[model samples]
Target: MSPVLRAPLGRVMRWHRPLMLMVASMLLLVVVSVAGLAFDDRVLLGAPVWLKPFKFAVSMAVYGTTLAWMLSLPHRGRRWTSGLATVFAVAGFVDTAIVAIQAARGTFSHFNKSTASAERVMQVIFGNGVLCIMLANLALAIILAVQRVHADRAMSRAIHTGLGLAVLGMALGFLIPAQGTAQTALTTGGERVLLSSGHSVGVPDGGPGLPLTQWSTTGGDLRIPHFVGLHGLQFMLIAALLLAALAARHPLLRDDRLRARLIGVAATSYTGLIALLIWQALRAQPLIRPDALTLAAAALLAALTTLAAVAVLKAGRVSDGNPPAAQQANLDGGRVG
Candidate 1:
């Protein structure tokens, strides 16, 4: 890349070193997981034993990288927030490591309560790590919500809203364990065993599932909302970047306020999508087989979002004048130029 391009990219890519290292370790795990997939024929929970570890490693890498970049965006509050970042890094790694370990043992990583002391202890540790990561991310989200982390209006909105949605998505994970169907089994020694609640509602966990993703196809899967919500931050950030890239071809999008308003629309739509997924999951409806009511709700959300986008663009076209001094001062908590 040319110096001009490299300079700008460097500004955008500023990363927290520890988090980057965590991401690197996850990438290495990804490679190891792939090799496991190629050689190991073991299957657990209706999928290859290695699949869970591979998926988790990839998720950890993406989430850690996004978080590191977000932490870099803030010019202030670095001192206090740094501790939270470290907490997240440690917790995320521990959580992923436990998953990998369980995969190697050819057992379920999550929702596993095998009635063995070792299994129970491992689950406790893994659960605590996940909780720590969630709490740390929540702290980061609160900090970003209050801090003026970015100068660009659109980018600022995107970052703040994305983190908030991601936090919500992480929270949704709790529902997976809480709302799953409970079942009882008998051990070979004639001991009664109660397994942890599984992920699929109205169906067993190891039932028919979508390929690759393994989302439940025959019944509701709580992971759907959890997965979608967790990645909403990345989706919104990508949407904002795509809008910025269109500025060169579309003169109107060059205005930061206009772009920011469009981002607001996107954020609302994304939030609604999360809500819809949760509703669908709660109803014990498969994601790919939504009922009429679910479809109606989805259609309503889409129509509302489209109308909001059109309204924002129309308003932008109609009002090209600069705002009054008072209004200008109010923008971005009175920090707008």
Candidate 2:
């Protein structure tokens, strides 16, 4: 491939060098998710049942790539940064492995102490490992927050905001561990799982839900905000990258301050959306069954986000190289494509 053709496509995939194993595993999981949809007889929480594992796999992919990109953007890092990435990758793998393995075994992994003592012990061990991964994520977020990506201000803000919000999302998992399973109450079988927690809050698990998400059309489901917030890093980083790509073609986006503000606006609005989801869920409102209050809040948030974005765009100005810009800005200005 010519250097001209390779830079655009190759840079996106190869930059920051993501965990190859995690990437490969995610590909396999996506296939398994589809296959299970066709073949698996299991049903959990009113979904296709393999859905949990599939979702977890996809989430891990996003988490791994986002962090990998963030860490790689920098020229150097602390000695432990590499170790943290490995922890995240391993934990993600174990997470998906447990979910898929249990799914194949015809059992629940999260709140499934009801099956056998061995399974119960394994679940507890896995759960602890998950907590450790969350801590690793928190540490990464802290590092990102403090470190200045002097190379690219827009990307810097995006990384900081994304990592911060992602930590919030990851931390939300605490809710699951804190609240015991609402569905486990009815099963009068062997050794009921006391510490288990599922999606549903007001109603029991396995009811009518939205098409793919199975996000509980009936009652409160914490997973909604949790899911959205967890992807915050991806969301903002993509936006920043898109802006840079566009700016390369249309140098208007080379305005570093403007790009940074636009990213900031996006991060703020994204947080608001996540907050809305959490509020709606905590009130036991289904995603599809939003009441007047929900509609009003949603409308207000949309209007505010749009207005803020417009304001940032208006503030944008083309750079005239008054002051020497960072290497990234120059690259955005077409010095390096």
Candidate 3:
């Protein structure tokens, strides 16, 4: 890699050790899961058994990497941030490990109430593990919001907004188990127990789904919004980074306030999209099959976002060079004329 790139990469490498290790482990598991997919033809829920493991590994890896970078930022409460980050790392690892273990055992990992007590135990562990991660993440988000991390306004706004959206996304997962139908089943000991629920809405799980995501193609899949929400932090951070890069060529973007305002617009639009996806899923509509109402809502959101972005740019000051004489006079004579 070039020296310019290696310097930033090295800084990233120095992020919270536990979180980075968690990310590394997840990446290794991702490779193993892919190998399982290639060799093991076993199917679960109408998809490759290892697919869940792969997805969880990837998700956890991303989660860890983002968290690690966040913890690396110069902010107040280093002790608190580090402790919470460690907890999050452990919880995420345990969560992903449970999925991989259950997949290796050829049994359901999530919402598993199978006759086998082991599967039930694993499910309980997974639930608690996820809950722990969420709580730790919530605490970290609070810390980031309360403290000054980045000197650049645009990047700082992205970090804070991203963390907020990510917390909401993680919370959305709770809605999944809440919405599915409950049913009674007999255990191995002839005792009746209620199996929690599944991911699909308005239809049974394991139905026709999008290829790798396995999101139901025929009915609502809450995972759609949940997934999008969880990654909001990564997306927004990337957007801010891209805008920073564009500042080199674009004179308007050279203004930090303009870039921050643009990030705000992007964050608002992203949140709206998440809300639209959740609404569609709640209505038992498949993501790929949004109805007219959904389309209209989406168009409105896009138009509003475009307008807001344009307004921000128009109002933003030119930081890189002199403005036109007419514009300069208007700026100087504004409200005084």
Candidate 4:
């Protein structure tokens, strides 16, 4: 056999490589976001644009790597993981293809100039695709939660808690009224009164006429707060998986350590991002900006967090370098038995 074919495929299949790829993918996303914010006009030029295809390619790669890693886990919930992985993988591929097609056709650049009917059809197709991905992600979270509850009660509780908080925040957002006027209106005896005007009703301007809400309803504009809040599960799950990868390097309590880290990171990052998004939503400010201060802070945070996680993982591995005599004896006995 060729040396390449004889090489260890199992080593290549290890979680570490996929984790590293995921990190790289996220960094790419951060860079793209920063570039888009910093050089909007230059980076977003017309059809067959260089950057657009590259960005979509990177996204597809990230999603594919993540799905592969998750499905490779040796867990009782393999069925669920495989199913969700397939869904996400398919969604990612479809999304990339759609974007590529649009880019080829100059739809993104000439969206405003496109015929109304063509625009409507494209909108429905893309909207449905996004909806499918969101539903698959949500379902994956629920399945994982159920599996954790049966396999590890404590981890299950943490997952459930995060899920509950996310749901609660979304519900509360809906109940709170928007700033300006009633979200809905009723006409009686030739008189009109507003019925709803809050985040809960999805009418932030107190009336349905607001451009933001109208565009959002048509899937033209995305509400940052709502989008962030709704996808809280994804963030938390990713955070948890990252910590788990870190913990797996250790020998003793490796699994437990990974689980703890995942839960902690998930909860912290999720809460922090949600709070920030909500604040921006309330103040009518963009969640992301090209401000030097914001960029610097984000870069610093990412660096510090990565360093801390690496340090903890290294320490755990060092601590678990040797097993106690009792554990060795038990292992020998089991092997003999």
Instruction: Score every model by TM-score.
Output: 0.89, 0.83, 0.89, 0.46
**Model 3 C-alpha lDDT per residue in residues 61-157, reported as the tens digit of each score:** 9878888887777899999989999999998988899888877766667776776777767787889988998898899889888766898889999
lDDT of 2 by residue, 1-337 (tens): 8999888767666644436568678879979888997897666544566887888887787777667666666634655676777777787787788888877765677766466777877787788778878888888777667777647789889988988888888887777545425455322123344435676667666777887778888898888888888889899989988988888886657877788888998999999999899888878889889999999999999999999988776656423444446765876779555
Tens-digit per-residue lDDT, 1-337, candidate 1: 8999999678755677778778988999999899999998877656887888898999989989888888886566787678888888888888898888878876666776777898899889999998998898888888778866788889888988998898899999898889997665443234445667988888887788998778999989889889988998899889889999998898779888899999999999999999998888888889999999999999999999999999988887766566767776688575644
Instruction: Order the candidate numbers by lDDT, best to worst.
Output: 3, 1, 2, 4
Candidate 1 error regions (>4 Å):
1-14, 184-194, 321-337
After superposing candidate 2, which stretches have Cα over 4 Å from the reference?
A: 1-18, 177-181, 185-195, 246-252, 317-337
Instruction: Tell me which of candidates 2 and 3 scores higher on lDDT.
Output: 3
For model 3, the superposed segments whose C-alpha errors exceed 4 Å read 1-10, 182-195, 317-337
Model 3 lDDT, residue 154, Cα: 93
Candidate 4: tens digits of C-alpha lDDT, residues 1-337: 7777657555445644433454455456546544543554332211123344455556456545544544454456666656665665565455555555554443341122234576567656654665565566666556655555424432454555455444534443333433423433222122233332333222242222232222123111134455456545455556555544655674434556545654654465555555554544454433433245445655655665566656656666765765678998999999999
Better of 1 and 2 by TM-score: 1
- The total of clashing pairs for model 4 equals 9
Candidate 2 local lDDT, residue 226? 84
**Superposition error at 109 for model 2 (Å):** 0.9
Clashes of each: 0, 0, 0, 9
lDDT of 1 at 55: 87
Note each model's CA RMSD in angstroms. Answer: 5.6, 6.3, 4.5, 12.2
**CA lDDT, every prediction?**
0.84, 0.76, 0.87, 0.48
What lDDT is obtained when candidate 4 is compared to the true structure?
0.48
